[model samples]
Target: MAERPVEADTEAAGIRDVQAQTRAWAALWRRSSPSSVVHVDATALSDGTGQDADDRRRSVRDALASAGAPARDRDLIDDILAEPTGAAGPCSRFLVVAEGEQLVNSVLSRPTVPGEIVAYTAVPDLLPLLLDRRGDALYLVVEAGREGGEIHVLRASQPSALRRTDVQGRADSLNKVQAGGWSHSRYQHHSEEIWKQNQTLLAAAVDGLVRELRPRFVVLAGDLRAVQLLSDEFSPGARAISSTVQTHVRAAGSSRGALDEHVAHTLGKLRKADESAAVDRLAAGDFENGAVGVGAVIHALQQGQVDTVLLDLEAIGPRTLFALAAGPWVASAPEEALGAPVLDSVPAAVALARAALVSDSRLMFVAPDRLPERAGVAAVLRWPTGPAVPGTPRWTQTP
Candidate 1:
């Protein structure tokens, strides 16, 4: 994505708008959830007579009574404790009351604010009274310090399942016919017993991974048998399964580098289908040159001749498209075209332009090297809304 620099005025306004929006959203969210209002009170008393501890405690109880909060017969004290307290912060003295497991009252008395109320609240009391209370699925972790505090709320994404394996094996071989002889290709493989164990293990791993990532699709990569095993080891609710029979040069536990490459390749292949189909319809003399310069794409978009925009995310493209709200034809420019900030890669910029064309605002990524020259980086012309079919290619050229 392009990093467009904002002017000072715009940045300040944006900050204010974001703050207002956050408050509005928070209010809406609170109203959407089950919650209640609560109040809490705390008090301390003077023990001026050098009286016994019992007398001093009685004075405190009398103070509480004076506050119109008399002890009830069925009241349950959740806890009560006193300790050395700070002069201007939270106190080490507090009490809690509960009716069975439900909190009813929570009060804290600060030593520095003796006889005067410090800080107290009753959510600690009324949470049990609230309906539809989410369990420990949610939690707030806070780090407190002098510069203020930071609070992070963590919540479970969703529920999912996976398989657990009970066994594994060394390796196996696959039959192959070489140029001059028949031979066996050695690779890591599992027998029926090992396969069963893997199925369980994979299922369990997939289940947990799905819950955490909440991905729309899951990709499986490895040798042919491993791909087959992945198909047999499906987890619930995953939308699609794609198997790639590629050698895994990276370690299984070190899945980051190799697995990422596999995902990129698989997704690229899936997107390439559209480009390939478009290329098939190309006739002789279609492209002025083998190259798909920026101007050609802009002309195509202007003529409403694009159904899909095939782009390579890793390459630098000379031209970029900008959509204006008023018309079918879009404005085109060179790199950082028309002063619009360019994305990190050419494919990314093209993807941004393609997103404008998708009904649901989704774009497919592709490798630039995969397209035929005649249709290279071209948008598939949409019927009736696009340019008419052109003549045959002027020259046969590779993408």
Candidate 2:
């Protein structure tokens, strides 16, 4: 959930800062995006009576065949089972692991898209390795032992880096100036030439690396001039989104390494702050204050008091609110309506407010508290009239 949607703050330097903008974008989407990676492993069940070892392996293979493991790994599993293990008690045993084709196919069958690596390891020892390998998604490791003739599901963990930031470098910018004298002209010409040269150098470096490494994103850390140069050259391809980031070092490789650390820390901080803010907003009576609360907002609509609606991007089910009149409301969930130009959640609310500059109705987001009270769901209302106009029951701004 978001308190407010897409907001941009332009600094004096002509730099645009979008805070909590993407949150709504994610929420306003129509479908759930899958995770980055999915890990899987295969093991055979053991029967206490050693006679059925081959049967147990066959059963395990059959189950895996239903899942999407690779033919090669499947062959490998068969080979391993056929080979004799010296430490065997009375039964036979085997384990299998695959990452490239088999794991991918298995995950694709599922509903979501995983973003990171999916590994299959026999033991947790690989946990550290998986985490090091851009570990950012869901991990499912299947541990099967020949326990009474049947295999079983063991343990699963979604090990996160606790720090994964998509790093990108940016540098281009524009500004409007009132100065138009000979001095300004000369300065502009000199500045433009210098900037162009720097851009050319950085562009070459970035383009070369991109061609070779093919990294998802690049984080450039150098002098401000050089950074901007790269931004201008790369902006055409939309290869990366650039931002003004601080780096203590200046060397290319070293700077990129330093940037990894900085970005990870920064993203962690941002995520934590976002979470805290969300919790607080939900706790506060924002829901009741605006059309945020499900019930009151709905009631307001039935009474024709709700001129507009402020929807949360993370909210669920458009069917829940179809009873309300058709007007501009912020979209909170990532689902699309059958027919509506849905704005990203919080952004939708803000846009409605801006549009109110002309229309009789206004739009705004409701606080979390009001969400439950108005909707009749289990939620707290921060205040009674937060969403209502000062002297009227109608809400003009998002709570």
Candidate 3:
């Protein structure tokens, strides 16, 4: 089985695009003939040695064999194993199998912690990967000179250089003392004008990039003065997302590691803050437009009201929910899921994940300890639903 490279276009999928893909995957799971689904997670360092890449590939192969997939499906596994390791950016790779056919093979640019492989009866477990890669942050690192500095735009730690220009001014040179009066004053004025020009140019470039990227957060790094000037240039929305880092950009070879570390740390902090805010809101009875628990969340998802679904990573303790095949509803008990074919013994989280994806809602995972009131799963809705009428079930029950 030789795995082909993912299409270049899919490699650039943004948040909305990935949501669409998830929806499509859910639909496929619903409609496709029943077959074993294999998901493999292979990770290799961005700068790993060749041996590391080979080891990663072999590991994927070994995982597939351990899965005990049918002999017919060996080709699918082989194909996935053949995919070049370390070919992608500092991200992990995933492959999905169904009906003994390879369904999805792609590189995910998001960093997944503790990667693993699994075989599921229905849909692949994609919620965690999608949540991790949600590229909502844009990172910008610039240098501080009157000469233009390097500008790198990172959409979720994936870097792409946006621009680099020369700054126009030079700082006061103490090495050569010129005439004490008029000459010195003239030099100072000229330097100020150059600085002003550089600032304007830098701001314009940054403003354009922000508008185009439309990231949820902006991380700024490099020289302090340059960082400030660039921060001021951002649009109001970008400013709202902006955070500054103390890491100063130095020469290429020496500064890369430090700058990258700062950006990663800042992004991690922002992610945690966002997660905390969500959890706090839920804890405060902030379901003005949302719902908590598996039942309410599933009901909300069926109505396409959910905007984001939050799950506690540690709360996925047991399989307590079931899904109706080819239907838009889920039930707390297999008996409640009447008339439709039921996918029995499904993990509640997995079922909810599929529902969330089918509705094109975002999925977020939080540490189990941080979940509000120990609520294992919840959803932030797009709009408020009317109060549940007593004794009236959301789904029709067979008498």
Please count the clashing residue pairs in each candidate, in the order shown: 21, 40, 7
Sort by lDDT, top down from the best: 3, 1, 2
Give the number of the best model, judged by TM-score: 3
What ordering of candidates by TM-score runs from best to worst? Answer: 3, 1, 2
Model 3 residue runs over 4 Å out of place are: 1-11, 14-31, 34-73, 87-92, 97-103, 106-115, 118-120, 134-136, 157-180, 228-237, 250-253, 280-290, 383-399
> Which pairs clash in model 3?
1-78, 1-79, 146-167, 147-167, 148-165, 148-166, 148-167
- Candidate 2 structure quality by residue, lDDT tens digits, 277-338: 54454445544533444444433433345444443333422332221012323233324232
Candidate 2 deviant stretches above 4 angstroms: 1-192, 196-220, 228-255, 286-399
lDDT of 3 by residue, 1-399 (tens): 011343455335532334455666667656534443433455442233477766665555565567665655655656565555544355555666665787666566654543455554454566545555653454555455454454544456333443333434344442233668888887766765666566667666656656765555555666576667666666787677667767665545545566667667777787888887766655443355567777667777767788888987566567567766745656676666656677655667777776676667777777776654566788877765545467763222111
Positional deviation of residue 27's Cα in model 1 after best superposition, in angstroms:
26
Candidate RMSDs in order = 23.8, 20.2, 6.8
TM-score of each: 0.28, 0.27, 0.72
| Candidate 1 lDDT, 76-106, residue by residue in tens | 2212312222224343233333222322222
Top model number, lDDT: 3
The positional error of residue 266 in candidate 2, measured at the CA in angstroms, is: 2.6
Instruction: Tell me how candidate 1 scores on lDDT.
Output: 0.34
